[model samples]
Target: MKKMEDNTLVFIVDVKVNKHQIKQAVKKLYDIGVTKVNNLIRTDGEQKGYVQLTMMLWMLPMKLGSSKLSPIG
Candidate 1:
């Protein structure tokens, strides 16, 4: 996950899973408190017959504050 200058959280995920599983995972994140979840892009995986997904999310300050430091620095 990455934090933008305006405080929006960005997540680029690549998962070798099906669409249903991806929806379930995103829903679970929302259920657990992730806000403004968005599916940025979805594409087939490099490997044959697999899938990949990309998501962008905006996180609450309280949530970001409690998390570990970002690795970007």
Candidate 2:
């Protein structure tokens, strides 16, 4: 639960999903290259995946009723 200085994204994934699946999914969905994958099972019975990306994404949250994301300039 600590702050990550690296370009890491935390995702709550299914228990059956493996590291390879997570890596591929991230690439396909977000177009971000993953450098590494770390998995941890939380006490609440959920799997948290720490995805370290190859590049930093300067993207902010979508606006109200927006269909796409906008990167900060």
Candidate 3:
């Protein structure tokens, strides 16, 4: 994991890594639950199958939209 501006972080992961794997790894390693995940696949001449994973972890759920804060909205 690389440090980004402010407190954000960036990670370069393999394309084979699934969403569940990412969630487990982030939770196990950082003890934080990711609020959202953005995945972009980049397949060029170099790599057969490559993807960029972007995970946004919420420090506090209160900052999110009111609707998102509720379990059933």
Candidate 2 global CA lDDT score: 0.72
Residue clash pairs of candidate 2 = none
Please write out the lDDT profile of model 1 over residues 1-73, one tens digit for every residue: 3444433434455545444554466456644323334444445533221112233233432444654545352
**Model 2 agreement with the true structure over 1-73: per-residue lDDT tens digits:** 2224666778889988999999999888776679999999889889988888777544312212344644222
C-alpha RMSD between model 3 and the true structure: 11.7
> What are the clashing pairs of model 3?
none
Instruction: Give the 10-residue window scoring lowest on summed lDDT in candidate 2.
Output: 57-66
Of 1 and 2, the candidate ranking higher by TM-score: 2
Off by over 4 Å in 1: 15-32, 42-68, 71-73
Poorest 10 consecutive residues by lDDT, candidate 3: 45-54
In candidate 2, clashing pairs total 0
Overall local distance difference test of candidate 3: 0.43
- After aligning candidate 2 to the native by TM-score, how far in Å is the CA of 43 from where it should be? 1.6
